[model samples]
Target: MFPEPNSELPEDPSAPEEAYLESPHHGFQGDRGAAPVQAAIPAALTIAVSREAGSRGSTIGARVGQKLGWQVYNQELLEYIAQEGTFRQELVENLTPGAGRWVEDRLQELLREQNLSQHPSIINLARLVLTLGAQGEVILIGRGAGCILPRASTLYVRIVAPLPDRVAYMSQWLRLTEEEAAEQVRLRDQRRANFLATHFHRPPGDVYQYDLLLNSSLLGEDLCAALIVQAARAKPGALRGKGL
Candidate 1:
């Protein structure tokens, strides 16, 4: 298995609007109710998985989605954003590569230029995530989905691994030397931290933001997914009538 990178930084913090514009995951434009896939799934449970770089959060999310037979909102978010905004698919894909500095910058600009109303993409993405939560089971990975839909009947999870473990994972996955992986981790973590701080004004590692924090290296992906699924099922009224 290709080890995932340890951290992913936002492309640029100064121009979030551009980031939103360039992002394929921002939101769709024109017709408001275009994404019918969200409506097809039955309402049951919603899971939001946030993680440090190289923590295997995406793997865990995919496993959870498979076990539950629910839609996994991972990279598919980019497609949604592209469709919603009527942006060229290729441009969005290029912007979303790796850390996504260009996309982040665009996002910053959008936030500054137009209040939330003007940038329907960001608002709609948030709304769509919430709508998915309301309609059926989902596993959302990253893009501040956890923070945006805090009150929704959702299980917010954070997955982290020790620095050494993350570095090792990245080295193997990226086919880089250990030192190179370490450097990449440092830069990526810094970028992600800055993005969260600059845009959301919240610390990225805030424990209060997550319902549960799991050490992926310790528990492994399958166990972590099982734990999340268990928690989601056990929590009463977790996904009731909550709204964004």
Candidate 2:
């Protein structure tokens, strides 16, 4: 959909001091104390993403958000869900792709041991994805959001890089040994694949499910974000009623 484009480039509801989340306008204000403006924020546009581990998907998403002046929901989406629901932060954090298979398996075992078959985080995540997607103007990263949202309403993207490249990126980003980064990449990739397969009954890597596939190693994060912004702009309803 992008056809190769050129590269270019918080707050919270919980506290009174945090205005990013709740502020309808004034997103560019230095802080909460800055003078508020009456500018209207752009209406909703949905971007669903699936990414290979260490591909800098989150970084690219952040850049894309900056370009579009929208909010990027990566791990922060999980935090929002935890705050909105009754689940504790620890349990919500444990639900991430970085948690590894053994930890998730152990958590399931503990749940079964207690005879509580349903996990709260799992139950909350799907609903959260759909609700957030519906809200629009949100960049949904990970959590298999590409599979959950309506195909016509969302621009689904998949990010990938060669295994060696991914490992190197992860090692540098996390300051981990090359071997450790490789292990992390492998585990996270498998874990996310399994997550989508188990919950959505679809292979996470199937090409047909996504409208765009990006290689961050080849394009770099900046170009990747530029490409996505271009693609999102091209989508049918993305520019419906606002100045994007």
Candidate 3:
């Protein structure tokens, strides 16, 4: 019972030029003129995909959103979150949930200057994620969304594979040498894991939070998305949207 794509996302007039930088999928244009419109999203289905480095979590999230005709938010979420002018670019780019890096400290300063009700970057991000989730038909990739949202309102998926397999996948997909790929994988995994553990107190790979966990190396991206779609449909209160 997948529905048509609700491609109309709220616009941020104050979004900086950097915010509109060409994300991986730039050709598919969406409405940029509308003020923030919050749709009625009761029974709206949201998917939060958290993955180990090189697990192709973002790729799978894209495929699932495309097939289901929903909006997939990845790098764009960063832009959306920062549009309110509370988060500085350097801070937003470098802030992590883990130990206070210099950038994180700067972000805290900016938050204080803005006098935002939500001071922590993690809290602000969680607010944005929940807002988008309430609008429904969204697939949020990374930024610790699965841990922040209510388990009842969202489908949390974790993607993982053997270290060697993930490293190899990154090498092939990104055209990096195996050694380079391995380093990228290691760093990214640590960063994500630390972000989650530090802010949410939840380990990235904790099995308890997920509705489904898949090994991307075994299932591949397409099959992994297919399985998630099937599972989402089977979940009680089936994801029925505006125009199925």
Candidate 4:
């Protein structure tokens, strides 16, 4: 079994656009899109998924990857790094794909997020995400990928369900009592809200920002996966600048 992985924002209805969910992928260092990083437009398509508490986001993501025959990246970034040596070998060959300094330049920009430039883990994770976004044909879940990758080349999907359904799902999945499940769900939802606020400065569960917003309870994992696959296939993701 895989371990579970880990934004707030208020919306102004009168505003034309939400600066919180901007195109620039400033990510964890600060508010989403608040900082600018220069990079080229990505030509390949990538899918970024943000899911509701107690939802089958990880399952749906893996199903989508299977259907699309693409690699699914979820949970802690370190798990993939430590467990898959083959991945490490492959990363070297794909580091610099073209004339653009997208990978290197993007890495530097990502450093400004937390101002922890010397932090190896943070640097490694940022580099991995930027590179993955560049490579395309990948599905990334959580870790603020929605805010970290370019909007043009990534298909952002949000999965949600009613509170009651989520409570039930959590209770069953985690083998907890109903009350315990409810508390767990609340804790999770609040954490996500905080994360969005900290990183993206957007309201909790900002459905409008995503390209496709799904109710996993209604669509089910397979159907949700199918829909995401359809949307991703409909358009090829592209990176526009010389830089992720």
Candidate 5:
């Protein structure tokens, strides 16, 4: 999926007289124009899935990836960060779910340090996502990828379920009581919303950010996946390269 590499340009004739006298090279050769660069068509589908806790978002993303023969990048992105940052993968994974608030605050504080020479790790994550997107396709779960790559021809889907349904699902999934599950969901949602607002300066619940917002409670996962596949397939000139 890389863009065509540019050819070397002809030597400039506007050099200073002393430099021209010192140099052995003189007149330029005829132009050896190379063929126009063509971008390769991506073989896999790139999807970004965002959902509240206990919405079965990961499960649905996994199924979609399997159907399309694409790799799922949900928590695997943390592994990438761990490798790049020289941190423990498990530590990064543990810091992912509702850990955005702590990470954002810590990174913000780090940015304020005058001695800091490099961008925060969060910026590194954005670069990694963009690079991976250029190299074929993968399903990215959470981490605000929708906001990060808003211009790409990405299938941005947000999954939402009724509060009661989400609570019930979380109770079973997390082995927690109904009351505890409800509280956990509430806190996690609030944490995610705050994190997005702090970093992206936009509301997390904004419907305009997503191309498709599916209510998992109303539509089954299979139906939702089918609809997404159909919609993506029907879109014209989506996979064409606009620019590198």
Candidate 6:
């Protein structure tokens, strides 16, 4: 349905420093490189994990990806979408071997289907999620991904903890003072709430919409990821990747 990522995403040797700062992943695979995803993911399952800031959502999502041999799409989706000019085109162009054209063509189709053309960021984001959803074998973290992915085939999960617990975790992880951590938590929550409202027309922190709701503080990150892996295995319309 879209430009699929390749298993081995080779880095570009001559990419500018700014692209590296923006991508975090291997520099967008240019013509010298191939897609950054597997080829045979047409009918696999997807997991959309939404979590409170500092809840280790990205950490757990990475764990799930490792255990399941899938790709985890994180904040880079939002970052890439936010860019303008050469960067945006560069982002799309770095996918499959010949994906620049294919991605553009498919993206236009999605924009037309959803009747959205105003916000480039939202449109690119929609392109990322929908294409990843169609190909499957993805664990998408944050950015209203749970609300956007096709429900029937996607395992939507929300990970949360008490505000105090999240603050403690963030403080310890980022080496911030407790007061600073608490404020960061509040800010993160408010920002996500606003993003959800503005982009997806949904409220943040709504557990009712998910396939499973997990308390990471209680269950712990490893256990939470294990459970998500188990649940995703059972989701219908999905075939486990080549092995395991």
All candidates in order of TM-score, best leading: 4, 6, 5, 3, 2, 1
Which stretches of model 2 miss by more than 4 angstroms? 1-43, 79-120, 237-244
Judged by lDDT against the true structure, how good is candidate 2? Answer: 0.72
lDDT of 4 by residue, 77-166 (tens): 534662455785467466555513575676666555643234454455555677777778899988667766767788999989999999
Q: What is the C-alpha lDDT of each candidate?
A: 0.68, 0.72, 0.72, 0.75, 0.66, 0.74
Give the Cα error of residue 41 in candidate 2, in Å. Answer: 17
lDDT of 6: 0.74
Spell out the clash pairs found in candidate 2.
45-137
Residues 127-171, model 1: lDDT tens digits: 455445545477888766665553445688999999999999989
Clash pairs, candidate 5, are: none
TM-score of each: 0.63, 0.64, 0.65, 0.69, 0.66, 0.68
Off by over 4 Å in 4: 1-43, 77-93, 97-100, 107-121, 237-244
Candidate 3, residue 154: lDDT: 80
> What TM-score would you give candidate 5 relative to the actual structure?
0.66
- Which stretch of 10 consecutive residues in model 6 shows the poorest summed lDDT? 235-244
**Cα RMSD for candidates in order:** 24.1, 21.8, 21.3, 22.8, 12.8, 19.7
Per-model clash counts, in order, read 32, 1, 0, 20, 0, 5
Best by TM-score: 4
Q: Is candidate 1 or candidate 4 better by lDDT?
A: 4
* Residue 169 lDDT, candidate 5, scale 0-100: 94
On TM-score, who's better, 1 or 2? 2
lDDT of candidate 2 at residue 91, scale 0 to 100: 46
